[model samples]
Target: MDIFDTLDDTAIEEEALMYDYLNQSARKEKIVRPRVDHFKEWDSAEFHRRLRLITESVEYLLFLVKDETETKTQRNQYISPMLQLLITLRFSATGKFLCLYL
Candidate 1:
């Protein structure tokens, strides 16, 4: 199974919450959706909320990874594989965001 598929239900829930928060923040801050004639006014709190959500999400992911990686047979094997997976996932996610932004 894919690394993402290994994420438990709690992780999925947190990820969903993070996405929702980010989307809401983007909508309010007009970062993703520009303020057109019919668009809503910008709100600074939305930006803060988005930042909070992102911070929390990162913490959650780190915790999950740490907890799983602690039982490794050797540090080398665990870290390298984990790092590679994390890097791949990070790049994929970043690429998607870049596409959306562009």
Candidate 2:
């Protein structure tokens, strides 16, 4: 088998493990956060603020990973944008993101 096949096998195993963990965790009692009354309204300012925070956090994480990789490689290459696009396309087609660890 080639490297891609090996990687694909590893990803499938990892996802199965993750699914098992999530299923187990779901069985436990969990506290749910209360939703606000305006949650369903698109014009709610609170919802906009929450959305902005989520976007910023995702952006920050992508930046942090790129920064760390650049520090080690010194080649100034990053995979996040391409990865994100691939993920989006995969989800659009398959209804799930493909597990790509690298």
Candidate 3:
């Protein structure tokens, strides 16, 4: 008769676990993911093939947006402008959001 009656036990348990995780007292520390230097890793041909732009062109775009994209505060080391630009271009070129994380 009620909404609780519709959700199975597994669903109810999962919801409870998610609620607990969201309300945990101790904040989890930020994860420091290892960064790959794409500029160094990919050759000019490979970079163009993947991202649809040569490294030099990417650099030029980065130079334009570097001032705006840069994090003003030093509290956390944010993703670099170059990396942001690369991720965006990769998404634009391939239309795959998962590629950004990989």
Candidate 4:
């Protein structure tokens, strides 16, 4: 049997459509005031600062390139690892790609 077969709308009054018009719910309205989020810049700046300090601590940069290797998979060349690291940090910190710009 279909569920609609047992249903009836004849007893439903027009006022039923507007039952909440006169009565307010127990749930209250919440208004959020957004202030200048200074913490965002502080986080990004701090990350950059920390990254710079860490990099500076290392006197020399090291590379692990194979002397005779010449195959494929040059993905790192297209996207700099350092830049991807920064982007990853920002993305991870914000939990969103668009939120970083905001």
Candidate 5:
């Protein structure tokens, strides 16, 4: 009965219609998209080198942050030690949450 409720219903109906259209097109055309391997691109030597460079850059950034945090904590009387959390992308790829405290 409310305007917001009507807007929500319209959005949900649009999503359902879009999915139904997609299913019908897939059945009619039988189109199959080529499979993609995200890791396959990382198999090359150049990709390895690039990955190494990225890793070093990230490590350097971590080091800078850690050093600055330690320096600030040492001078502050009420501040506590820094807490570092290292979370990877693997869990995010699967729509999961993972917290790793280091």
Candidate 6:
């Protein structure tokens, strides 16, 4: 005569079904965020102006950080190291970042 014995099978099944429904709805609501294609859009001078780093220097930094910043997953992977580095540099240099909307 414990609490576990008092609970019915129907209650457990209902709770499980509720959780499954919530999970399904959440998966459906998943949003794909837009990313700025800065590398392709910006030229060498723009890189220098925004990040205060030359194009070659940024590429070198990307090389330095590639091992540590790389994500192992192929599906829904994190941003590239170069982009991460560029964002950091941009924030440090200009103290400005554009808002990302969902």
How far is 86's C-alpha from truth in model 2 (Å)? 8.2
Writing each residue's lDDT as its tens digit, candidate 5 over 1-102 gives: 766666777798898999999888888654555433333434455433433334444356456666554543443243321223122233333344442425
For model 2, residues 1-102, the per-residue Cα lDDT tens digits are 776666777798898999999999889685655433332443444433434333344446556565443334423333344245334444654575543435
Q: Which ranges of candidate 2 are over 4 A from the true structure?
A: 1-53, 68-82, 85-95, 98-102
Error of 6 at 80 (Å): 1.7
Q: Considering only N, C-alpha and C atoms within 3 Å, which residue pairs clash in candidate 2?
A: none
lDDT of each: 0.49, 0.50, 0.85, 0.44, 0.46, 0.80
Q: 1-102 in candidate 1: lDDT tens per residue?
A: 799888999999999999999888877442343223211232444422323234345446656676655554753334433343344444555543222322
Give a tens-digit lDDT track for model 3, residues 1-102: 999889999999999999998878567777977789987899998899789998889999999999998897755666878888988998999997454434
Per-residue lDDT of 27 in model 3:
79
Specify the poorest-scoring 10-residue window by lDDT in model 4. 57-66
As a TM-score, model 2 comes out at 0.21
Off by over 4 Å in 4: 1-11, 22-25, 35-89, 92-102
| Ordering by lDDT | 3, 6, 2, 1, 5, 4
Superposition TM-score, candidate 3 onto the true structure: 0.61
As a whole number from 0 to 100, the lDDT of residue 99 in candidate 2 is: 36
Q: Which run of 10 residues does model 5 get worst, by summed lDDT?
A: 80-89
Candidate 4 clash figure, as a count? 0
Whose lDDT is higher: candidate 1's or candidate 6's? 6
- For each candidate in turn, the TM-score is 0.26, 0.21, 0.61, 0.26, 0.21, 0.67
**Better candidate number, 4 or 5, judged by lDDT:** 5
Candidate 1 lDDT score at position 41 = 30
Q: What are the per-residue Cα lDDT tens digits for candidate 6 across 2-98? A: 9879889999899899999988888855687877788878888766777888888888988888999888884674687778888888788878775
